[model samples]
Target: MYSVVVEANVQYEKESFTIVGLPVVPIKKSKECILSYQHTLGIDITMKKITIHLSPADASPPSQPN
Candidate 1:
């Protein structure tokens, strides 16, 4: 099985949420879910810029040795 690393960075700049490293549409669409959960947890991050990076966005099979 392949593995992927997820990293996040929140900046105090213009309110925006971006997911890099070639995320799928569902991953990109998670902002709404995240916001909802944050609201439920009483966490206020409305003015922060949230960036999520998925390391090794493209996963390929291991190289075959000769």
Candidate 2:
């Protein structure tokens, strides 16, 4: 198994949200959930650059034996 860490950066820019660094499908789909939470918390981030980075960015599964 591998240990992964998540880091988020929010910057001022034209409205956009992005997730980088080898995110899985479920992670990509979590945008709506996140936005909902943000709304519930009363933090409007519609006009900012949101970047979520997953690190060690180059993680990969071990190769199988031949």
Best by lDDT: 2
For each predicted model, how many residue pairs clash, with residues at least 3 apart or on different chains? 0, 0
- Cα-based lDDT for every prediction: 0.73, 0.74
Model 1 agreement with the true structure over 1-66: per-residue lDDT tens digits: 446666789989999888766558756556566667779999877789988766564666457999
Q: Which one is best on TM-score?
A: 2
What residue pairs clash in candidate 2, if any at all? none
Candidate 2 lDDT over 1-66, as tens digits, reads 556666889999888888766558856666666777889999988789999766563566447999
Candidate 1 TM-score to native: 0.55
Q: Residue 30 of model 1: what lDDT?
A: 60
Off by over 4 Å in 1: 1-5, 55-66
